[model samples]
Target: MSGQRWDMGKDTLSTLAKKTGGNTQDLGGLVKRLAAAAQPLEGKLQGAGHDAFIAFKGRVDSIANDLNAGLAAIAKGQSGMDAATRTGESDMAQAAKKAEGAANFDGAKFTKR
Candidate 1:
């Protein structure tokens, strides 16, 4: 009666949440390290070069911010799925049994499953 299914458990959700948090922290640390490592070189650049570098760093930081937000959303959804599993949400449980790959996800329409 099914072609495919997706299954997840509390342990998987918990581990994913933990890993996502760690990744967020690591990303922040990496950004900080990049800033620290670049401080020494900023002085070497002059005028346009320094301005360009600054803009690039700003863009990178912005992308990282977006990435962190997406990760957080995914982690939150995972937790919701876990809750649904625990509380016996039939729809969520049924969907879990037939979930398929999403071609596009913006993390903007996330709802408690």
Candidate 2:
């Protein structure tokens, strides 16, 4: 006997996608709150302080925009992967069922002809 065996575990890609998508949602909410909080600070400073704040704020705003876009892309990718995994799992299930019906192994041994 070769003693070869196969063990296929449950699919977890969809679970990972859900978790990653949830993280993006949480981060997106925080980004929104940050932008809102930054609004009232505009025009409240003077001189170099104001210049520095303005410059940094501009850069932060740009970065926030990019971050949101990237997070949105991540969410989209997660959704797509989740869907693909689900479909792939269904196909695997059907195939397994078909294979089981045609299986040649008995409960205790292989019945090779």
Candidate 3:
């Protein structure tokens, strides 16, 4: 048996982090387009015997508004996640640099003077 271990959680996290921004934008755009397309249908349903149709159109408008709000919330959450990820990456790099510097300093101090 080959000694290869697969870490699925790490791979999933990396893929999600890479795609979060693009996916969020695409979803937001689709929601906005859906909302826009629904707007004209509201006007087209204006007739005397179409009360139910009018009511349904109103409900559709409400749903579109809610979807847009949800999209905004998703975007805000993605922004926060991106900032946190960048900060985490920077902290890890800084820690690695400090550890490397300390390792070199200790070697030099032990061998010289």
Candidate 4:
């Protein structure tokens, strides 16, 4: 009985070792194939990232240019408004001086009451 039990134990251990060895070989082959498959994808991902960065930089530049143009327009409009205000003030001052002179004149001499 002891001999039979020992033989069975030895056979089971041998079978387990054979299966473990085969599985290890298969795992190594799978790892190699996975690495090969991922190589091209890694390069493609890097290229995609670079392209996206360039596109993003272009967009940022365009936005900055547009903002600068808008600011320039706003500055031009502000200068124009300042000029118009100064002209209006000058005209008002002249009108007020004329009214003052007219008030000092005797209206009774120019009209028969």
The TM-score values for the models, in the order shown, are: 0.52, 0.52, 0.49, 0.44
What is candidate 3's lDDT per residue for 1-110, written digit by digit as tens?
23333443324344554566346556656655665677666667657636765565456645655665665666567556667777787899999999887785655565
lDDT tens digits, residue span 1-113, model 2: 23422322344555555667667656756766775787677678789988876776667656666777787787678668767777898999999999999987667686769
Give the least accurate 10-residue stretch of model 4, judged by summed lDDT.
Answer: 8-17
Deviating ranges (above 4 Å) for candidate 1: 1-10, 46-48, 56-67, 88-113
lDDT tens digits, residue span 1-113, model 1: 13322435446666767788668657756775677688788879999999988886777677667767777787788678766666776777767766644434566577888
lDDT for model 2:
0.70
Candidates ranked, most accurate by lDDT first: 1, 2, 3, 4
| Candidate lDDT values, in order | 0.70, 0.70, 0.60, 0.56
TM-score winner between candidates 3 and 4: 3
The candidate 2 region of ten consecutive residues with least summed lDDT is 1-10
RMSD of 2: 8.5
The true-versus-predicted C-alpha distance at residue 3 of model 4, in Å, is 99
Write down the TM-score for model 4: 0.44
